[model samples]
Structures are given as structure tokens and as C-alpha cells.
Target: MTKLLQWLLGVSLLGAVWALVAFDLLELSLPRTYREVAWPIPLYLLVSFGCYSLATVGYRVATFNDCNEAASELHEQIKEAKEDLRKKGLKM
Candidate 1:
């Protein structure tokens, strides 16, 4: 799950970077309305992305050890419970 989250984060970051680059290129080529807000757009996007990236990294790093252990333990417990139920012929 952590690895999946990490992969998702990486993909999101790539998408953000692509958007930033594409918008920058477009703005450079075409002088659209609200030129005043142009400069701030890239900065805002970068800052927003940086904030989210840092939050995800922080969460992952903090839970790095506990997350994996808990997930495995929970899986084992669930498997055991299922086996017990199956032996008892429970509907679940």
C-alpha cells in the first residue's frame, strides 16, 4: 500500500510538472488575458505541489515502519479468521 501510494505520488508529481511546463510554454507563445496573473500562476502551482508532496512524503516517512508491519499483521489475522469461519461452515 505504501509502495502504491508512492507510485501514485510520483505519477501525480509528473502530471503537475507537465502541466506547469505546458502552461508556461503556452503562456510564452500566446499572450492571453490576465497577463498580470501570469507570473503568479507558475509560482502558485509550484508552491501548491510542493506543499502536497511534502505532506505525502512526511506521512509516508513517519509511518514507514508501522504501516508495513500493521498491514501484514492485519492480513494474517484476517486469513486466520477466515479459516476459522470456513471450518465452522459460517456464511461469511
Candidate 2:
């Protein structure tokens, strides 16, 4: 399955289970403590996902590679453009 579908399926399953437990819809006779914990579970999941996303972004940025050749080529093009502009009496 696609990543989005997989994620949605997982989330839906978790939410269904959480609803059943938090609301006692199934009459499972779960303890009150369980319900108390289940109430914050969504917030915990959101915070956990946020933390994971931040860590992934930080790791990728830390390991990102620099393109030196492209940088120099861009600099040369800029210089040529500036020269052309100067020739056209566009003082800078």
C-alpha cells in the first residue's frame, strides 16, 4: 500500500481502539485508570509524531551535501550578467 494509506489505516485502527476503550463502547469493563490514560493518548501520539518529524528533518539537514560546482557556475553567470549590465550603462 502507499505510505499515506498505510499511515491512515494505522491511525484509524488506533483511533477506533482508543475510542472503544476511552468510551467503553464495547463494555469491556476496563478500569477507570485505563480510560484516564487513553484520554491523553492522542495528544501523546501527536507530540511523538512531531518529535519524530523534527528529528528526521534535523538529521537530513545535518547530512545534506553541498554542490560546489553548481555554486561556482552560478557565480560565473552572475558575473557575466553584471558585466553585460555594466555595458548597458546600468551602474551598480
Alpha-carbon deviation at 10 in model 1, angstroms = 15
Candidate 2, residues 1-92: lDDT per residue as tens digits?
A: 99999999998999999999899999989999999999899999899999999999999999998999999999999999999999999978
Candidate 1 ranges with C-alpha deviation above 4 Å: 1-33, 67-92
Of the candidates shown, which would achieve the greatest lDDT relative to the real structure?
A: 2
Estimate, for each residue in 1-92, the C-alpha lDDT of model 1 and write its tens digit: 79999999987887676565556645555444445455466678789999999999999998877578889999999999999999999997
For candidate 2, the per-residue lDDT at 32 reads 98
**Please, what is the TM-score per model?**
0.34, 0.62
Where's the lowest-lDDT run of ten residues in candidate 1?
Answer: 30-39
Q: Compared to the true structure, candidate 2 yields what TM-score?
A: 0.62
Model 2, runs deviating above 4 Å: 1-5, 67-92
